[model samples]
Target: MRSNFRVALIAGSIVLSQVFAVTASAAPSAHPERSSLVEDIRFKVEKFQLDNGLTVILHEDHSAPIYSYHQWFRVGPRHEDPRRTGLAHFFEHLMFKGTDKYPGKKWERIIQANGGSNNAFTSRDYTGYYEDMPSGTLELIIDIESDRMRNLNMKQDEIDSEREVVKEERRFRVENSIIGAMYEALFSTVFKVHNYRWPVIGSMTHLNATKREEFKAFYDQFYAPNNSVVVVVGAFDSGDAKKWIKKYYGDYKKSEIPAETSKKEPVQRGQRSVTLRRAVQSPTVMVGFQAPKAGHDDAYAFDLLSNILSNGNSSRLYNRLVYREQRATSISSWAYTAQEAGIFNITSELKPGQDVDRSLMSIYGEVYKLRNGLVSEAELEKAKNQVMTDTVNQLRTVSGKARALAAAEIIYGDYSAVFTDLDKYNKVTREQIQNVAKSYLKPEQRSVIRMLPKE
Candidate 1:
């Protein structure tokens, strides 16, 4: 289970009109009768920095006697050397290989024995490991997490074992899966030089080439107090939790992460497309349009545009393609904003005999409508409501709260931006949505990947 992960294409970000973060639980649910989701969401977080530079954020939720511990690092595929490629994700595998104190699966066993669950995920922008356990075990979590952060003992045998595990993960996810392969290809075709061109799971060749020393050096540089954020949400004495955090995480010296340097992906000049054949039952297609980074004035509009096109069966693309024409088995879209450039993506699994070019035409037909015509007031309002509802759901749980907060801090560097999200979406005029579609969704700016059954 640890070998598997889901790519955070959205980078735990754009939670823009998406409204994600350390939020939710205000004294009164914003008067449902009232307008303004902006005022509707809120959170109280206490933040402190350790002497060693570990930033801690605590949100006390006494509603349940449980807490979610999320440790986020400013390290992921984005920080990886193009040659070393998967090193960021490689550590995701290594981190769990265990420290001398909790060697092997004992670390997982200890947590499970204590009635808690733990897992981790890698993304284009960052890596996050989390544990959800009863608040009673807070100190236990801190002690063990801190221990592994500094004392992980990685031997060549362990590294080799984990490498093989990730290699299989890539095979299963990218090499074998149709939708998976299309998504991976979409990034590569869309960017010429950006690190985003690579899969978060990474390529098998680089995984094989990366050695133990490279892994050790990466761990030493990225897994430091100065490079990570610790967020705890749920029932716990904020004061006691702070003390435990200092005792467990303090003392470790910060590492000197070299100044990050990566060439900006050169501007994409024209439409790009790739056709890949796979042993699949149905043809699949994905289209990606280069868009702005998260926190861009335009990111929110792109997100709303995505929702308007794919939020449900009634969405424009779904209504036109699936419900009406039956060209696709299913359809979806995303405006994935990240620390770097973002992509506005549309994906569809087509009927067995659907013509790929015809499918592309049908999909573009729906998109061009938004570019040429403004969405109805009612339709635009519905998209805003859906975006708000999703954001509210993101705020409903402590884990959701941590992700939103951590994303805001790490991706945008301002936790408070979370509070303004609903208003951001609310203020997006219909014209802004249409204008963004016209500006970013041009054919020259698009990259398409289509997968067909092995013939």
Candidate 2:
């Protein structure tokens, strides 16, 4: 889920300049380069489970008066019944609507009056609600969250109203957005059996058809302590925070959850592609190649592969397709690290009058070549260092640290997975990068989508 976990950006304009530095071989280390100065990474965490089986992690950082509160639910669109494709996303919006204990909009008003900010997000694997506010008001924050979890008041009027809001959101985020449209089409065609094919924001068609009763049923099924994690980070005492948490959330009943193991996708027999036409500015192509999930050993190498290919302007896809080949105006790629499975995406926004098919072929050719040839040790190190720097910087901010720990604990089953992840990354050899490519980057494993400008 997008959640409140932020990927912090430090002052790296100098590093940004080297975005077009991709080469047939890696550059020598002797080239003058300056590492961005980063703050110390430190967090004091208290981990425990409540009587009802709610997992909680608290990070005490008194550096500032503000704190970040997050409640991450393990269940997301993956757990949703196929009939309720967008229920998770819908619930995300409705959570802000008041509950029985705190009726009307008074709950949010109370928090805002106390100087706080809040938002939530839904992904394929998780839905997270979070708030950032002054540390002194931590109890109020917990109170608000606890009330909503157990005492949500879902009136038929509110449900009908919010459903329309969700439909409009889909129109804005999916129907109108070109890349968003491409993402939906690509994933739908790519994953045969996996629930990943369904977009988290859900289908407007399904949302409109959903009954009020079904929405309440969805809330009961997934919104429980057993499937959630509460993370509070910033200036606070862990002991006091835990005491208040129990006082507020201890009464929430544990609900029985269904055993959830879904059928995995079979090996790809061949390449897949889709086309989306809309009133867009330029022709765009999205290419996806299936890869291992986040914790899989291959995930680290795939991440490095993404960094080398398209992490920044200096990366291969950008430098080659945009600057060197001049195939399109801009080119970029992303290695999406989702919960269960992932994809390496190369996106090219074509130059006016440029051939989209030609650009797509050239980009695919580079990935194919990488599979056949081993990347140099120098290239591998460059990618590794780049990721390390980003990771360290992400942990520097208080909010960042909290999010890192929270995501690690909820997503990977332990906060230590964050550090362990780095260790695994450090052990990746250049050969492993080539191996993942050879195994996962075959042309047949790809799903290509071209979003063309409306005629």
Candidate 3:
């Protein structure tokens, strides 16, 4: 799925693990930076479960005459067996294929006629579907969503068609793109046991060979009401909304959703590197190291460090590699906080004639500075501001609000954490940033992928 919104990863795990099984009804903690502002901004959330095991989280916003209806399934690439992959991504496409009642193109048309826009995304942690529609169309959306969930007509032809689309997607997003190819290689090299090493889109062989029965079996097992959370944010009448939900989804049966526990990767003892010779204008390298899941305290430290390293030309890596030294044309870093242990990535495209080894050494040299000494107070403050800005921007729309609520519930394992994100980041000390850099960014814990220009 192509969309105007969203990119990559399952939300990295942290502060609250899935064991907590959070209900969104709790009050949010105050924002110390501005108590009045945090106190004034609150979401009146209603969290409940239906008899059939459907979990619903509602955030009632009456300022607008529309609602963001999002359903998040706990199934993702991490849930699949090694032999069978990409089924989760397949269902993202399959969900819209429709049941006998609505069937084929009719499903999208109804939403379009109602002045709504809809899209879905699949990640390593979970799969989600959403529709942003006028509040008046709540019942209709509910009825149709229920219909497709219980009565999806899975067909061989449709599966075959979608398979080709997925294969092409792999080509476009992975094989043909330099950054994507490097990441695919980086993750696979870094993770040996965890499915996080397995790309969210899955292996090409699995996509080409997966059968209809296998797809249906996966759907029956994982696509249950018990395995998902439905979020309705924006303007909607909660009273009427609950009624429509029950009328449509009340009687649906819950399936025995499988436990998604997979093997965690064993610790890496030494650096692992993959080198590629490709036809390109410039050589590039992507180095990845293990970082904490979102639930860990260090996850926040990793986030702040990502900013300090590469947020702008003023940051460490950019200032050293791109601007000051002029060893590379570009440089950046990301601390991916997936549900399981995450990855900290630093990628730089070398100046056409620059030395790859030197470029890599320079990248590591700046990281050494962070480990050797604490970042300045100014650097830390700028990182927090950048992070806080990104968080606020995500909530600029009702759809973004629903997405955040869904991620908080499913990805963070606690919806209330969404409210305290600023508090968490603000609490991260410079020492913590240095400590995480020392702990996780060791060369032994790293996996590097270098792409060289072909002869």
Candidate 4:
């Protein structure tokens, strides 16, 4: 349900490709634009645990004949043993390698017969599996998922095969892309002790070093039914889905999950900087400011600040850096919206021969002005409207709703948060937004990265 969140500067190139032209809606907005705090936007959510402790949530949406099956596990790089940096993401690939009961071919046959597609991803906080299929094929989807969850076919040979595959994935994604290389270097230098510094795709060296026994150990520790959430969305009888889930998943036993007792990162005392050299035509600059978690009150204000500075062509950074100043081919900012503590970042790709230092200073000037003065009421209104419009539009498709439900439930711990969380954005004021900028966007709390063309 969550968006693919990379570092702000790097994510800009990809996010920009998704033409997010937020045109104002013409018809009267049926629902109240303002969030109604007391009224929970409850779907027909029924929760149950199988005999083995797998948590299942069923929400019946009969808008169409298709269904989305989403499964989320409470493990990610954050939960990995310090030495096991990419284990979570590595396991994400292994999960699809076919189980004993559902070998790769058999699993594909069922999915192909049912007109469904499936994929999985791993993040810092969680890993997720999802399938979109015809509503009538619920049983096939359930069977495949249950089999893999309990009985994975982890062989030494298969692990070796997937490790090479994952290595090439890292090469393609991190080694090839200019910005991706920059992020790998940036995070490596940025977080001295936090697990957050490790790339989610994992290191090729670590992936190769991971033993098959390690995979089994990881599965036993975190892949229990109790530590996972099953999300079913689309046209279906809720009662029927629940019965099928219990029958298929009930026998799995939940073990006592191990606690994650990693070293907590101490507050950073000073600014840090790093440089990356890539064989690219243009240079790029990135600035990351440590910010609050997604649940914090100030987070909403920071989200608004991100939009005001770089959400669109009309945003301040876009206008200043790319349009007026003509220093950058593009400029953007993002509040790394995460459930855990995250980064507020700005990125700019320099126009040929542009002064990087001057461009960086200009960007700083924009932040200084915001911290010193209130954003205009009109600007605040536009940002709020943009957030509302985007939220409503995301639910326009069944697959999108399913993704939203899975993400909200797994990350925020509440599916109802899809609607309730909007309140934070609605209630943000100009002064509060300015105050947050001043509080969190200080030089001492930030990191700077510059990627230059290889000399």
Stretches > 4 Å off in candidate 3: 1-40
RMSD of 2: 5.5
lDDT tens readout by residue for model 3, 277-363 = 889989999988887776678887887787788877788888888888898888877777777777888889998888999889988
- Candidate 1 lDDT over 209-319, as tens digits, reads 988888888899999999899999998898899989999898899999877665687767798989999778888998888888877878777777877888778888898
Instruction: Give the TM-scores of the predictions, in the order they appear.
Output: 0.93, 0.90, 0.92, 0.92
User: Model 2: per-residue lDDT, tens digit, 89-148?
Assistant: 788888888787787588778778988878876667777788888878888888888888
List, residue by residue over 273-352, the lDDT tens digit for candidate 4: 88888777788998877777656788778777887888778888888888898899988777654556666778889987
Compared with the true structure, all predictions reach lDDT values of 0.79, 0.73, 0.78, 0.73
| Cand. 3 TM to true fold | 0.92
**How many collisions per candidate?**
5, 3, 9, 7
Candidate 2: residue 105 lDDT (0-100):
81
Clashes of 4: 7
lDDT of 4: 0.73
Model 4 steric clash pairs: 1-403, 52-252, 52-253, 52-254, 53-225, 53-226, 54-225
Q: Relative to the unseen true structure, what is the C-alpha lDDT of residue 319 in candidate 4, on a scale of 0 to 100? A: 89
Clashing pairs in 1: 15-19, 15-20, 21-404, 21-405, 22-405
